[model samples]
Target: MPDPFSLSVIVPVWREAPGIESSLKALASIREAGHQVIVVDAGSDDGTAVLAGPLCDRVLVSERGRGAQMNAGAAAAGGNLLLFLHADTRLPADAVTQLETFMTSRSAWGRFDVRLSGRRALFRVIAWFMNQRSRLTGVCTGDQAMFVRRDAFEALGGFRAQPLMEDVEFSRRLCLVSRPYCIHSPVITDSRRWEKLGPWRTIFLMWRLRWRYWRGESPESLAQAYRSDVRNA
Candidate 1:
């Protein structure tokens, strides 16, 4: 008999060829344990799909956006549960066990705590605040590796068709169903963005963006501003 509580981990990528293989390889054990790993590429020219093909169960080509790519992955998944993972992030070793506990629970959705892949003390401080803020506000970021039951995901209609803050928007909607079942075991996410802008500058930029987003700014505008800032940084 098939496992009723199987998980499908979806990774959305765009030009992530440099680390795509390693990222998918990390999920090998999950695949071996009867879960599914789907990599959705948003029209990468760097052969990301080719590199990811053998490591995961399926490699899909989708529209050029994280939200669209993730939605495509969710649509193709065969598991009862769906996990939206980033290509630059790696789940903890005990993620399968943590997911099993979530599968047996009544939670509609969940996210893992996130730790930046930097050895600096400031990175730890940043991660601490991020976890605390998520716990307090019931809001989650993509770096956290969000997961939900496939039914709930389908009901919510997957991610919004936005370039940024899709995770925040989805989390707000998911909150209407149930508070996130946050696991303490942290997922390690790349800190290259922070490193690019310097930690404090990145934090302030993000806070400003979120504040504007909350003030009813459009995601397209926010994404443009983010790109400009990152380029200037």
Candidate 2:
């Protein structure tokens, strides 16, 4: 097998020019530690690819949809480990090393840590919810930046291209065999959506959706609830 440290960080970007740069910056730092970063563009006409320029090891444009873009990007990546990241989220420092420690030993298939932003107070409750859910279900959102062994990823198949909870579904599939890692170091995610929708209200919406999911509501239904609740920019 190739070295476990041979990892590829994949980011699926749409029309997100503002935050993609931050993600690129963090990925650059990860590259400094010896890892490849691939930006998968989903019809991004807003110069998102242009900004990515030299920061990424590869930038491949794909059809719209996060799952499709990610699959296309991962197909072209040479890394043994595949990390799926969001355009608006930042990766943790030493994430590659942390991942190496886990994958080298085959500790767990893969998982993301908690999600946070600069403001600890604002994210305290959010962190609790995310960490608790991850611990219990072995699931992590896209912001947590999920990684998987390349073979396992292909075996389990990639994301579902669903409007909502594709990450959740992917995690569920991953947990069918064993738990994924919930790394100690968390990644910071932009709180702009929460800020626009009111953190408490946003939390409530997510809770409601999760509850509905637990109650057998479909992921599409859950996504529908949030679709009207917040502005997706």
lDDT of each: 0.94, 0.79
Q: Give candidate 1 misplaced runs (Cα > 4 Å).
A: 1-3
lDDT (tens digit, per residue) of candidate 1 on 7-74: 99999999999999899989999999999999999889999999999899999999998899999999
| Model 2 lDDT per residue over 1-233, tens place | 55546888899989888877877887777788777899999878899999987889998998877778888988999988888888777777777778878775654376656666647487777877787878887877787888888888888877777777777778888887567866778777777777777788978888888778778888777777777777552
Error of 2 at 42 (Å): 1.2
Residue 153's lDDT in candidate 1: 93
Give me the overall lDDT of model 1.
Answer: 0.94
RMSD of each: 1.3, 2.2
